[model samples]
Target: MIVVVEGISAAGKTTWCHQNAAQFLIKESYPEKRPDRQAGPGEAARIWTDWNAKRWSDAVAMERAQGVAVCDTDPLKLHFIWAMWQIGEVAESHWTAQLKFTRQALQDQRLGFADHYLFKKIDPDVAQAQKDHDAARSRPNFDLHLRLHASLVVWYETIEKVLSGRLNWELSETLPAAEHTPNPYRYDVSVFDRFIQMLPRPRR
Candidate 1:
């Protein structure tokens, strides 16, 4: 099973993966120098397209060997592209080429989509606090981060529709809604269990 834990920065994806003892990989762990903003838009998009395809291929290999793998973000680069565009970092003319690249990668089976997508929803205040406390790394401004997060949610919703019958997707939530206040900051273990249960069986 290949599961993706996705959300805005400071959404606790890495933390949840750690607390649950899942076989986890974080995107930042594989650091590549991204093309500078001054780079031509087409060049930057192409670079990220290739990088994301490779990342997805690597995760698929891990899942094949280990029976399970969890990624801290979606291997598809669509969300990244969307974020860059939202922040006016990418030229509009590059959109078509980038989308084409992503589609071709999927058709070629070079970039495997997640079997399940778990979207973490945290309170804005909590997320902001987490960002503020992380002094070592520079993060996007809070408003920009929020905008990116919203766009990601919409993107995943579209993915769910596109991948209907092929994949499972869910938001972090506890059962029996009346029993307790939903803690937006963390995912319940039940969410993990649900993912495991929904995994497709291997062929003989």
Candidate 2:
């Protein structure tokens, strides 16, 4: 089974991943040169879609070897663009482009939903305290992450409707166990559409 741990910055995802799934963890990553704000959403979403697809592939391969593979973030990260748009930090075009590319990737089997997810929640004050005490990592977007916190819940809640029993709202004290079931929606576009349809329609 593939397990994804998703949360805002400084929410102990890395700490939990390293502690629990160290040998089979696929950590979150950023592009070497993230596109600038001036870049069109078309090109930017394609690049990001590929990055997330690669992570999904890695998780699939690792799960074959170890029974469990842990991802620091959801590989199907279209929620990012939507969440950014919800915060008014990006144009709706970005979310649309990302949704298109991400849905296509799902249809192509380049990315798929995980077998389980830990949508860990954290208080803003607790996150700030963690950021202050941890000198090693700098969360320059801590404020932005805090802003996205509520919006992210909506994102995951929408996912739970499509995925049903596969998600846990909190991280477990120990690695949660999941059995490997034949994933019918691993490459199903209808499942992708259902997930999107559950959310508010994107800008026309």
Candidate 3:
């Protein structure tokens, strides 16, 4: 089983994962520092494409060994791509390339769609308060983060719609199934593809 905890910055994603002590897979940190400046068009796409591919590989490997995995973020990097586009840090071609790669990863099962997604839904005021508390990390554009959070909420809803009966939807952190219940529906590439395509374009 693989579960993904998702939200905007300071939305308590990392904190929940830590508190649960699940096999937390985090992609934000790299052994080396990332390129500070935005890369030219396709370059940025290529970098993230490869980065997510590796993330998928690592997560799968862990699951194979441990039987369960919990991720701080999804390997699709949906929010990251949208946020970058909103900030004008990436071009359409870059987003296109990344989306293509994401589609391929889903199709190939290199990255399995998360069995469950836990979204930390909070009011805008609460989100702002959390952001302010985490002052050590620079969030120069709070509004952009808020918009990204809204976008992700919509995307997750679309995913649930596409998966419909197949997905076990749970808004809170509570487990969706009992210990004895069988999980009949597995990852469906077609449903996942539709979910990916349904993601809204970043507002300019």
Candidate 4:
């Protein structure tokens, strides 16, 4: 199974995935893309074009090996991030089409990317790091800022919908604080132990 573990940038997903590697083949949605790049002109489009191709190939190979792939991110969030950054309208037909393409690709590859939902959660440190990085950059483009905010909004909504509908598999965590409070490291010792206990039995 391709278990995709995603959350806001600093949501401890990396740590969680590493600890549970025996149960999953962890990966980020688009690992090849550079975060420091300026998001403007044709950069986003070009990146997506390359991303889709390589991602499809990588996914197919992983599935063929019957590997338990746990991706850190998925193309869904990447495109959503881009759409938020540049297009400004996720509901637009073109954006919808791109999202559908991603969905279809996952299905075609038989790489089941599990959407583990965590709602109303954003890692404060991660957000701050991004903001600081952007500010320090010699020429931070405006489009990137747009996408950053948009991606955050979309991330919250996307997780909320998944949780509400129970579309993906469920993994519970003991939130350190209320939804509004900042719980960057929400998955502490107790939550981590719970996650470990819930790991699926290995496939034959």
lDDT (Cα atoms) of all candidates against the true structure: 0.60, 0.86, 0.64, 0.42
Compared with the true structure, model 1 gives a TM-score of: 0.71
Per-residue lDDT over 1-204 for candidate 4, one digit per residue giving the tens place of the 0 to 100 score? 334445444445555666655344436545455532333423444456457546545644664575444455553344343435344443334443444444444445422223233322444556456546654443234345334544554544544443343223322342112223222322243432343234322222
Residue-level lDDT of model 2, residues 103-145, one tens digit each, is 8898889999888889988999998999899999988888999
Clashes of each: 0, 0, 0, 8
Report the C-alpha displacement of residue 181, candidate 4, in angstroms: 33
> Which pairs clash inside model 2?
none
TM-score against native, each model? 0.71, 0.94, 0.76, 0.45
How many residue-pair clashes does candidate 1 contain? 0
What's the C-alpha lDDT at position 69 in model 3?
Answer: 65
Pairs that clash in candidate 4: 25-68, 25-70, 26-70, 27-70, 27-71, 27-72, 29-73, 85-147
Query: Of 2 and 3, which scores higher on lDDT?
Result: 2
TM-score, cand. 3: 0.76
Minimum summed lDDT over a 10-residue window in model 3 is located at 176-185
Each prediction's RMSD over C-alphas, in Å, is 11.4, 1.9, 3.7, 13.4
Candidate 4: residue 64 lDDT (0-100):
56
Better of 3 and 4 by lDDT: 3
Model 3's lDDT to the true fold? 0.64
List model 1 lDDT by residue over 85-181, tens digit each.
6556566566556766666666566665566667776678888898888877577565676767755666666555644542334444421122233
- For residues 90-167, could you state the per-residue lDDT of candidate 3 as single tens digits? 666766766676667666666566666677777788878888888787867667777676666676677677655434
